[model samples]
Target: MQDVADQARTSKTTAHYVLTGQDQKLRIAEETRRRVLRAATELRYRPNLMAKGLRTQVTRSIAFISDTVATEAYAGNLVYGAIAAAAEHGYLLFVCETGGDPELEASLIGDLASRHVDAYVYASLFTREVQIPAELHFERTVLLNCLAADNSSPAVIPDERQAGRDAACALLDRGHRRAIWLVGEPGEQVLAGAQRTEGIRQALSDAGTELAGTVDCKWWPEPAYEQFGAFLDDGGDPSAVICLNDRVALGVYQALKARGRSIPTDVSVVSFDDSDLAAWLQPPLSSIALPHRQMAAEAIRLLMTDGALAEHPVHVAMPVRLRESIGPPRS
Candidate 1:
């Protein structure tokens, strides 16, 4: 500070005001402000944010706490989106992972609190019901890709039900009705699966039709392949299949192929989670995107709001990525 003031030929108070962005409020001359900034640059002066935070109680930093989001390659989008939003507001982010260990999570929370972090973003890779940590209950915190079990915290998640409705409507519009079957079971642990299934049912009901039947299988490639293969061997011939996710779609595709069936020609297939695999499939799969990045951005937006965020979860709309997999149903 003294070096900059001396180099700029200005008083230390003037240098302080300029560096802290208080010169404008004080009506300092533009020329003097320019000189202080130039001197700062030449001297390579860096302010001690921690010292300043001690006096102002504003650290201008946020903490992102999660179970496995930081470790997953694709799920890293959540951290990236939060970092971008925080940078736009001139704040830095601290990403911490607990690996689903409660003790580690508590320790991380305590350390962040000691550092005077301004806010928190609690995140999960999979959409499901979560219990908000008691440590974050009163803090400015936002939940990402998960709902609060107590419904007491602000949350951001993809609109699974709406995405399901859109997925079904896409097939129904192509003239598929009675012979359309769902390819995955809605497991109890995953909230997204059940919500999406409900949305599909609602859309089918609105069309004055219903599902022919559901081929129960775990939401994975291997399970999907085995069960769908079994279904085919049992004389199941469907016009279209709605896979719960892209992984399941892959299995369904392979099963259909083994039985000498062609996509859209013999059976149209649509799915959720427009993951990279969706595009790489033989005849690119049509799917509803998860909107991970958008959900993270919305979570940060709500966290940074001046006023309190609404307790109700914020729903980011899912987008339909259309491709060659869907077509008019054949007899």
Candidate 2:
């Protein structure tokens, strides 16, 4: 500190403010700020962040705690966004995964708390309602891709209902007024599934129509294949099929092919999750993409800002990636 002050011809107080990015707040002159910065650069003086953290009681670091979020391919985007945003805010980020183990999650949170982590972005691999753990320091934590059971903490999640509405509109806009079947039945326990189902119904109802039918099946490909293939065997004909997800869409595609039905030419298909498989299909699939990266970044930003938490949860917009799978209804 003394060396920097001497080089810049300024007092230790002025040098301190400038070095710590508080010069403007203290009304320090522009030229003096420049001199202090130049002196800092020349002296190769790096602030001891550990010591500073003790003095200011802020480490300028964040912890990203998750249950299998880092392991899932799409959910990993949350970690990437949090790390990138933390760096941009001049904060370090520590990532820890619990793999859905409760004991490990509690232990990791305890370890991070001891180090005085300034904030937390707690995430989940799937969008669902969850109870925030008692181990987490509530006020300093933000939930990602999940909602608090008590609705006590601020949260960020994708707008799945809007995504569903948009997905249905994709077919409707293409002049497909014929029968539209939903390929997967949403379970009551799954919040995302139920919300998407509501939106799908709303869109159709608003259009003076409704779903022609639905095939009850699990979200996985195999179950969807069996159920949809049976629907076909029973003489089910759909102008457009709205699959619950890309995985379900895969099974639907296989079943349709086995039955000698061509996509778009015979049946238009649309699904969710614009994952890699969506594009790789013979006719690239149109899908509603979950905004994982955006939601993660928003969670970090919300934690950093004061009085930003509102009663309403932040719903990040999902983007529709339209491809060749959806087209006008067959003649």
Candidate 3:
């Protein structure tokens, strides 16, 4: 700054204002501003960011701590969304994947805190209950796609129950009364699966309709194929099917095709997750979206808000993407 001021024959304050783009506030003449900039360019002058950060008490950076998001294909959108939102707010994101290791996570948090990051976002690939690290206490942090058991921090997750309700109602709206729900194995307690089932049941009950039955496929395409094929052989009849996810729906489609059943014309289908396969199917599959982007954006917004640590967890709504698969029941 001193070198630039001497070269331009101006006061240090005037040179500082010109170089920082604050010269408009000082009402400096345009010719003087040009001189300061020319001198700065000639001297290759650059502001020391670390010194500036220390003086301002802000680093303008955030830490994004995640579990498997860096490797998993389906949940990668969460990280992308967070990065884009952080850039929009003039902040940088430092992403670190813990691979579900508790000790590594603790160490990473400690290191980031030492670097003076403004805040932290702990994200999970899948929505589930999480135990926040003790190291995060008293820090500005937000949880994405997961919940803290003690509600220690504000969390943003998809509305699984509403997604389920939307899926069921999509089938019901097509005048289909008889339907079956193909689900994962019975004993596992996944919050998304349970909430979806509840949504389906509620919608059925409200419409004075009954679910024909539920088939547990262990959440695998092979089991789904075998189970659904046998059910068809046993003369099971349903006008619609609610698949727990897109992979199970794929198996259901295979079984129906082998029996010469046409989608929507014979049995309408609606599913969850809205994975890429949904749109790639012969006739595109209509399913509920997971809202990964929305949840991530909301997580960043929550972190930026005042008193965000005291606010309750927010559940974002999952939207339905309509495609070619659904229609009115057969006559």
Clashes of each: 0, 0, 0
TM-score of 2: 0.87
For every candidate in turn, the CA RMSD to the true structure comes to 1.8, 3.5, 2.6
What TM-score does candidate 3 reach?
0.89
Estimated TM-score per prediction?
0.94, 0.87, 0.89
- Give, for candidate 1, the lowest lDDT window spanning 10 residues: 184-193
Higher lDDT: candidate 1 or 2?
1
- Model 1 residue 114 distance off true place after TM-score fit, in angstroms: 1.6
Tens-place lDDT per residue, model 1, 1-331, is 9999999999999999999999978798999999999999999999998888888878999999999999997687888988898898898999999999999999999999988899999999889889988899888999999889888888999999999999999999888887889999886677988999999999999999988889989889999999999999999989999999999999999999999999989999999988889999989999999888788888888877888789788999999998999889786
Candidate 1: where are CA atoms >4 Å away? Answer: 9-11, 24-35
| 1 against 2, candidate with superior TM-score | 1
Best TM-score among the predictions, by candidate number: 1
- Candidate 3, position 159, lDDT: 88
Q: Report the C-alpha lDDT of model 2 over 1-331, residue by residue, as the tens digit.
A: 8899999999999999999888988899999999999999999989988787778879999999999977777677889999988998999999999988899988999988878888888898888888788977354888999998888888899998998899889988998776999988687787777788888888888888898988989888899999999999999999899998999999999999999999989999998878888998979999999888788889888988886566668999999999999888887
Candidate 2 all-Cα RMSD? 3.5
